[model samples]
Target: MKRFTCQSCGQLLHFEDARCDQCKAPLGYMPEHAILSALAPQGGGLWRPVRGCGNTALRTFCSNHAYDVCNWLVPPTEEHSDFCFACQFNRVIPNLNIPGNMERWRKLEIAKHRLFYTILRLKLPIKNRRQDPQEGLVFDFLDDSPDGAAPIMTGHSNGVITIATKEADDAYRERMRVEMGEYYRTLLGHFRHEIGHYYWNVLIRDGGRLEKFRAIFGDDRMDYQAALQRHYARLPQNNWREYYVSLYAMSHPWEDFAETWAHYFHIVSTLETALSYDMTIGPIVDGQATLTHKSDPYLLMPFDDIIAAWLPLTYAVNSLNRSMGLADFYPFVITDGVRTKLRFIHDTVREVQQAAS
Candidate 1:
């Protein structure tokens, strides 16, 4: 997530901002060019980039913009679609007529859009449900039963990711995290983990990398239900951290991959944010200092460099949180075995980039 500035008044902007606060200039994001620009009126409810990046096409915000859930643009060139590339994958949005559903859906979109930002930055392959009904990425934001019958479960199947609307509520989410014994949990983490399952289907199972993946993560052919049963039946304390990223990750090979993949996103994306702010965690105690790297985590940094920077950043941030009487910002430890798995994810993402080229 790079820092954005308003072209109209040079005010700092965030990716989700739809209008610049300083100059009141409308803002729109162009995913193809990976830019968030201030918008200028072009008549007939269309807008053009005020920054002038050689693109003259008039555009409109995604249809979702009307709902205040999306800030991405739809250029005139993509006349076939009314939604932005990210929103096109949504199969079912929450029932807006229901009270509080709108706010929940907004939270979901924020996380989902952030997930797409990283996916696009990584150059990962993603197709809409229309393009590949059997295995393309799609999202379903569902609420609990209206009659209070059953709750919506958050998980991924094939390529459709379902997120329970209640997860958007911070209190409910924290309760679930504690009940599940999870050290860390967030909306972005959910998206990263679920999308990891989607990518595993596309890049490993369909891309002929299953054999290599198995060598690292283990055989995914084991009965998943039984493995999950065993995991919940007893919390393994013997050497679990030595291998898996989390206890749930130890349940199945597929989950191990997803947890590791999620951590990879957590590390790299957070590192990019740190680098963007020129942050360095140099505690000038005796004779040691940390330095910020100029390299971009998405394109330039290798797995080792990412880990090097991420470790210090996590340590500093965790300490800061502790100082404020809050829980650790990053609670999990990255072991050597986990590092190996994360490197595999890093390499696999680079492979996707190469394959696309």
Candidate 2:
């Protein structure tokens, strides 16, 4: 995610900030311009960007803002719609009247909004069910059955991504992480991984890249159910690290793609944050090389350049985490095989971006 600042007072801002601490100015994120702008009230719930903040036209907060779950702006052009570009994708939200569901929904929104940030930043194609009824991306945040029936499983089907609301609880998520033996897991990671499935349908299956995809990620046509059953039934290969980004990625070709795709997002987004902060890693030894953020990872950096910057950054941050008595900031390794899959995803994203331009 790119760093943001309050345009009115120049106070450093986070992507989710609703107000500027220095100037006490109300803030709203303008997704079209990808800026979090300080706002000036214009009566009747409308607001305009403070002078010199950008877009002079009046705007209003998304309907979800009423729930304090979204901080995105709704432009006059989209006044007919009640939700922002990101919120419009919601097919079902959690039951707010139920105790604790409100907080869980808020956490879900934060992660979902961040997911949309990367999606928009990369200029990926996305639509709501209204635009493409057959396969438009949508979300369903659901609760497990209260009567002791089967639990909700978070996954994607066609264009819908369902997230088990319980995952929003940190304790629950952490427990599951231990039981599943995952190196890393979070709500944002879940969004990134599942959206990969949605994009596979759009950018690979429909975009005519299946042949190339198969050669790199293997044949996705294999029996997915059987592959998953086998994966759970047997022990992971001792050498799985050589070929997969995570143990779960060894389950199926589709999973490998999704896992790698999620890691690709992790790499580029974190690199962009480092670049925004002008972060650099100087050589510890006299003649060793230095790492600097020289290019925009989302727009200009090649796959090789991204990997070069990411590996060193990971090393630096992971060490910082260890020094502070925390787990590695990035727990997975990027092997040559994993890099090949990541490169495929990077190239495919660039292709879609160029075509759109």
Candidate 3:
């Protein structure tokens, strides 16, 4: 996500905020430019844009600001946007009164918003299933009742995506990561990766992209049921580090696509962030700084140049994390085989944009 500065005090601000840290000014998302902006103060924590802005001029703040969780706004005139874009996608939010459901739902929504940041940045088409009722996006955030009435599983299907609330808990997520022998995992990773699966299904559901896809990820027509069954029955491949992001990602063609798609976003966004900070890159080249916030401004950089910058950036990040007593943030390697797969993903996303345009 692009870094934001408080319009009220010049201090940096996070995207989700109701007030500024420096000046205590009211904060609102400027949908006009898609960055969060601080508004000049009015009386009693009430706020208004500096003037001549569209979203403020229309009036759009979260209905739930009184209770917390959402800081998004929608104009009164935009009946559709009355709900924040993310809230509009919800088909099922776990019963808030249920033990830990509200906390779980909040975590999921936060990750979903981060995921949306990338989607919007990429300019990918985002149609919610709830909004369209036919072909738009929607989410099913659920937790099986302790009683056995509904199916307990949650996953993306067709245009709708389902995420179990358990996935939101770090302990639960870590437990699954250990059980599944995954080297890296996170709630945001799950959302981004699963959305990749949804988008891939949308982008290549027809036969045209199938043949090339086969050469890269094997084949979509392969039996996912059997493949998943086999993967669970056996040990994760030892050499997977050379070829896949994690063991779970190696489970099937679709999972592989989603995992790779998630990583593509990870790499692109991190690189852009590095460029924006203007820090020196890594050691191999001898002079470039890794803390930089300025790389290729528009990501129009050739594939090789992007990769060139990332290698050192990852190393620097890993070292910094180690210094802080945390595991490396990115725990996978992009070998030749992985690079080839990534190129396909990069090409696919570019094609997706081109076709949409």
Candidate 4:
């Protein structure tokens, strides 16, 4: 979400831009540093990267050059690799040889990169299966076979994430949203929410925070299959709003954690954006705002401080959203009971950071 510049012409560039209109420079993303750099064309359509990146020594091409779905640079060091960091996470992408699959894959990567940007910004640990097969993350970008050979699924388990290829299609996603009765659905939201599932394995189960986590999210040891089946079997009761963020959270303790984890990123990222703009008035300077640097996350702003700020901030945002024609930016209100659950999530994150340190 930070602004990018074209190294070739020094013109401001968009993250999604394949070519800079001002200088006609080819652009590529430096995935390691989350940068978008522009390139000057050499003869024979070989674009020379003008950015002072280590990857340049490796001589790489952006995914845009291949499928137009990737903006991330693939270093020559990874010459044999077919995907960038965002695309690399995918285990079963649609058939790229298909006319539309490349475009579909492209959309999914954009959202995946956005998800990664937040994870990186927060200084969260990320290791893919290719890097660490034992516990590293992976993804499956699949679909109900075009030939009707198999059904597709999108969910997270253990350390892997799966996304249906149809989720990449705007029309298909909208149809699913209506059919599933969801108020909001986006590729970004799915990545964010599913990664929330991954982080539970990464952060909570390993951090010895399970007891406290169980106290709030219910017991995560419960059977996931039965819980999920029961949830879909009956409509989630709306009256339980005071206890959970979304109806899906009512499905199981693991779900509640995942939903809350996603919300934590939502709150932290937006607050940092607001702070970057210096958009606050009458600064009651929360201590976390002081410690959690806008550019570098040293530590999560104190868990208590964030909740205190959120209580009022979400209220103001909801009211403002109503004043405008749009629906509420944050549809779910965290009640007092839910606040206790969120506190556990916040504390567990700190524990993870401490353990990593």
In order, the Cα lDDT scores of the candidates are 0.89, 0.91, 0.73, 0.73
Per-residue C-alpha lDDT of model 3 across residues 1-357, encoded as one tens digit per residue: 667777656788777777888889777765435767666545644456754344555445655555466666554455445466657777887778887777887788778777776776676767777546665678888777777588556577777788888888899889988886677878888888879877786666642687787788887787889999998888776687687776777789898888888888888877777676654475433554434334452236566666777887888789999999999978889998788888887777777666767
lDDT of 2 by residue, 26-85 (tens): 999989988889998989989998776667789999999988899999877998788998
TM-score of 4: 0.79
Clashing pairs in 4: 69-106
Q: Give me candidate 2's TM-score against the actual structure.
A: 0.97
lDDT of 3 at 61: 66
lDDT tens per residue, model 1, 96-147: 8889889999999999999999998998888888789798889998888879
**TM-score for all predictions?**
0.96, 0.97, 0.88, 0.79
**TM value for model 3:** 0.88
In candidate 1, clashing pairs total: 0
Which of 2 and 4 is ahead in lDDT?
A: 2
Candidate 3 achieves a global lDDT of: 0.73
Selected candidate, larger lDDT, 1 vs 3: 1
- lDDT at residue 176 of model 4 (Cα atoms): 87
lDDT of 4 at 53: 42
Each candidate structure's count of clashing pairs: 0, 0, 24, 1
Q: Which residue pairs overlap in candidate 1's backbone? A: none
- Candidates 1 and 3 compared by TM-score, better number: 1
Question: lDDT score, residue 97, model 4?
Answer: 76
